[model samples]
Target: MNRLALLAAASALVLPVALSAQSPADPIFSPAAVRAHVEFLADDLLAGRDTGSEGHEIAARYVASQFDGLGLKPAGDAGANGVSWFQRIGFQKTEFGQTPATLTVSGAGEAKRFTHAGDVLVGLNAAEPHLDVTAPLVFVGYGLENKRLGLDDYAGLDVKGKIVVTLRGYPKGLPSEEGAHLSATKGKIAEAHGAIGMLSFGTLQSMKARPWARMVQMADEPDFTWVSPEGVPFEAAPGLRASAALNDSAAQALFAGAPTTIAAIRKTADKAGGKPKGFALKTSVTIRADSVSQRVTSPNVVAILPGSDPKLKDEYVVLSAHLDHIGVSPAKAGDPADKDRINNGALDNGAGIATMLEVARAMAQSPDKPRRSIIFLASTGEEKGLLGADYYARHPSVPIKQIVGNVDLDMPLLLYPFTDVIAFGANHSTLGPIVAKAVAPMGVKLSPDPMPQETIFVRSDHYMFVKQGVPAVFLATGYANGGEKAWGDFLGGAYHHPGDDMNQKIDWDAGARFAQANYRITRAMADGDTPPLWFAQDFFGDLFAPDAPKAPK
Candidate 1:
């Protein structure tokens, strides 16, 4: 057995004895209850619950009905009825037009051309349908400029009016949250450097995990972003003429006559404590893009259970899960009899919403009430770049300061009898200890993130809350008790695919246990006198909300 499995086995021996002494009251979490909800949400009738689609509306109404049945009050958009259970989120969708894009690199007495959507993928997030740029190319390492960390890829580079070529992420050994921040803002950094265009290539690790073909397939789909009612695009980066991601071959062509190859630069970036340097590429490139845009609205289902304590009642704890999925794939021939075209998302998020519903039911029915109000939010458009959560965070139904903490559920991968879980963002706040305490009596271990390089913390709905200065935790089944292989196989085979249907094997009991653990964590936070607080010197807290108060030393 692997080391993680051995550790899990060793822990399992002592956990039952420890848990047997403090079991909670009779079964509030039922596997049958969770499965029932999943069956309905993942049913084919819902048409995969695409954002802004009728299927998504059906799912939202279902969640609203559950909250109503549990006696939770509406806490969504203010309406003629004072408040409704549907918070409307407006979005603008952009689709790249089918104009054959070309990237031509010419220098060193040689030239190469790459076809868009194949050898490369290009798009503009702006509303304008067309953009064209011809400029000199310069390598900028990872294009991260963080003065505090003494890392600046553009320290001595002259990239103004040129195209900046960079890798997908920051160098190794940097804090994951910091790296995530740098990577996210790289485009802005390029634009700030007066670069007219940008070209990025995936790191070897990223490319291996998600192949170019899969990325190309998804790139063909429309991109959506939350927008204002006046139809103004939100925070669109200015001065970027064009942007594109190059395939491996296309990227390697940029360094044909340079002293260091792309491979060498990647090697340097991947090394422990290594920092790649920047240099001008011995090439010139031209890019052109075409796109179209439209507007749509989606609903975020929100409900509230008022707290019993007068002093703490105004504070709120959010239980969040996305209700949207990728929906049906574009129809094609040769699909297998069992292979439905719908990306049912039974595991991707039907399971998560089911867990959230069960948690809501348990909390609403409990005789002992929490001190803080609990908001059960079934967010829309998560698959479309966390639109619902982002909108809610920016335009909260309640006072933003009152929303103290968030617990997000998404794609838990309950394919095995998991004895441990990895709670993303747990270590950044006092929520870590609360999670530890809550899971102890359930014979479950709280494991550190096994794949920090993936930056899982910033890739989900909880990150929306984190960005708004809320302390949050996103829980997932961990790679313990022989679950590593299970998770890997699932991601490789079913993730975001039509295979994520109800036909896949799932440990319903594990789902129930997972919900129970989340319930305990939420209950502890609600009943506690103080809200969840950020740890002192946390990278995310300091970067996103420097003025927010920190936890007691």
Candidate 2:
């Protein structure tokens, strides 16, 4: 009877300790706190938080203050770097206002006037007015220049000092056979040919069938970028414009009285059957752009949790999340009243920021401190071309060689009651094995990338670290075959839209559990002695030396 009583006492003693370990991480991720931050960030008061805008300044300051309150060390020296954790990036913001743009073809019947902000686009092609081109027009099929394909769009034509109108992507299929044969990289060839202005035809019949067309094309609104194709930095290149869908239709109308449609002409070229005939339609286009240059400040909020082990503490594990969004879109396209002006970006990234915040707190309070430094980075300007993360990768507060893993969070949705986390780039790094080993008992399946062509591995801020030889993981909710509509409903509604508001729809309890999971996973990595390495056959294997040690099979 006495021994039985002792056994019962032992059982009672362990129960409280076990329950404490498995208890919910609610204290770390208070719904009130998460909602407060999300609501403030998504609020219209920030005025769409465009980079270099007043709203952007307010957001940056708020983030920096949070980092300060967290007692983070100044990652960048203020006087030496002329920036706080708040890194100031240099960029030119050009404002193009709508005025009247007149286009008159000498041979065409009438002069057409396109009002600024309505029917036409105007922007500075270069630093000066010398980029203005008033020349004859030449239509180039896809603007591809490749010797391997035995076809150069600029082959029998001189585009110098002329306006070159080019079609969009080449037809699908292999380089061999009747399929369209063109270099995958063709943007450089367009600029090299001395085409004063190149207008990309966006609306083709095939493009309409693409599932991602809706995401890429904002209806009725023209998206403009001075960005050149990769490998072709025209340092002094002239104006580059992506024509509206209407512009493509207008170009097609030019061959109206011809015997063949543009589509048929391209098909003929693909088969190498004959030279598709070209017609000269009197074409004249004028673009005026107002360019504004300004100096702006955004921040990368970083807090470090010093490790228990002295040696390993010098090395680090980074947790990153972009704190910027597309800001806001103009109202002319849809819902003129709201003006598409508020891009609250609740899911695109607001969730990511909140995750990092909770993870920081939870890991800090854990019973066992990590062996290596844990860095929580709130990066800025990810929407503006991954500028903040790129800068952090180049100018790291910690030694680049010492950073073992980069855990970058972007999109986080409600967790499935019984499913694995979807980690892209898992197979791309040596850290994958460690992660796999940790989640094994959790029933979390390590998945190889199902959508490789999307190049999602290289899309987020994590790519910046991976490119620099740091092993990284970009985690998102696992994909379920039956959840298409639910996925679409969540993403399509709030993604870069004004309706992305903070509401009860978000599963805060699940979000907190996910954050706890992240904290545990990262802690497991940081507390270990072995640092993760670049995986073999991961495309970036060359980033490590050829003789480098490989991850265990």
Number of the top-ranking candidate, with lDDT as the measure: 1
How well is each residue in 16-125 modelled by candidate 1, as lDDT tens digits? 21122236662356676676677777778778899988888988888898898889999888877789999988888888777876788888667888878878887655
lDDT (Cα, tens digit) per residue for candidate 2, span 1-553:
0132232123113211111223353234454455445555656667666665676666666666666666565565357554466655544333332433333233344444443333233333325423334666667766665444454566677766666665555533322211221322344465677666655443233345343345335322322222221312223333343222224344454334445566686565455323333333356555444333334456566667787898888889998988777776755545557354677776667777777876775675567677888877877777765767877776687788778788888967652332456576777666677666655554555565544434466678887787677888887666553234445676657667766666427765556555655766787689777787666544455543344455743
TM-score for predicted model 2 compared with the true structure: 0.70
lDDT of each: 0.83, 0.57
What value does the lDDT take at residue 482 in candidate 1?
76
Q: What TM-score fits each model?
A: 0.92, 0.70
- In candidate 2, residue 164 scores what lDDT? 69
What value does the lDDT take at residue 166 in candidate 1?
A: 88
C-alpha positional error of residue 348 in candidate 2 after TM-score superposition, expressed in Å: 2.8
